[model samples]
Target: MSLSDKIKSNPSFKKIAHWLMIPTGQHRPRLWIRMIVNPFKHKRGKNSIIRYRTRLDVFPYNHFDLGERSVIEDFSTINNGVGDVFIGDRTIIGMGNVVIGPVKIGNDVMFAQNVAVSGLNHGYKDVTTPPSVQKVETAQITIGDNVWIGANSVITAGVTLGKHVIIGGGSVVTKSIPDYSVAVGNPAKVVKKYNFETNNWEKA
Candidate 1:
């Protein structure tokens, strides 16, 4: 099913979805409290689990819609402020990574360390309000099936990647990418396309 269809299936997600829903600015302390107390408050179903030392800041509880058998590793922060975020089954969110919302991650996906996925970009046009005080611009980020996001990569808002896409380490993705493509570089570009016959990445 399509992502929109899948999201629509759960009506409860619309009610209480936000990062930092409460006004508590001391994120670290609140996170520690959850860690010490109900670590599973961020988790959805019984099969989903967060590994040790995983530090997730306050996020919309319903925004992180997890399928069965998913694991978020240590030091991973999922802060959903913009919109809904959904993680598919058997996906692994690596350590020291940060994922913000309005992002949908697919099944069997793997994210290496220090990966940053953010869907809300602060508005800078208004000089009266500081960047943080200015109106927040919202966008959606979509990662397709069997995708692998490499270490230290940053995925910005309004980007949609297709199925089986591979993002190399330390790349910054500012735009959308097509399916089955191997993308790399600063402001990531498609360097090669997958060749089924040769079983490798060939020049596009």
Candidate 2:
């Protein structure tokens, strides 16, 4: 097998790698890794603004890319420890947002305050092990262009939100939403769909 594959197959090596990326007893990356490694491994587009107060728990093992002119406002937390986080051009990640990756956000997306987009989930099937200590699972969450995610909305794991989609405030999205739709409420359901011939949004 190739060297990278071989390393992954070994659990001890994987543990060591995790330790190097993260600290001894913390979820966040070590200072050295953040300062030295991530800058070289990740991609940051031109004119992208990641505010100074933002908590970036990004690691070098996974891809973390910000597209051109995208802005991540203050108090936002982005973690790419388990998977890639890609945000397209001119996207605005508003204040107090939490984004955990394996997430792909398209261009011109607008996220309001306190939105949480997380693909990382903790396994709780093992009764003997605490959920916090159990293995974590991830699924990709895809968000398309010109989407607007309202305040306090949550886009859960493996959910796909298509282009021109709108998510209402305080919604908990658990399933995939197709293009040109509006979803709301807990376990968010599409309440509106764009009718082509009528050229208006009608009830779904």
lDDT of 2 by residue, 133-165 (tens): 999999999999999999999999999999999
- The candidate scoring highest on lDDT is 2
TM-score of each: 0.78, 0.94
Residue-level lDDT tens digits of model 1 in 47-148: 888787776554433355776788888888876545777899988888898988888999989999999999989899987779987888978899998999
Q: What is the lDDT of residue 75 in candidate 1?
A: 81
lDDT of all predictions: 0.78, 0.95
Residue clash pairs of candidate 1: 54-75
Candidate 1, TM-score vs. the true structure?
0.78
Which regions of candidate 2 are displaced past 4 Å?
A: 1-6
- Distance from true location, Cα of 203 in model 2, Å: 1.8
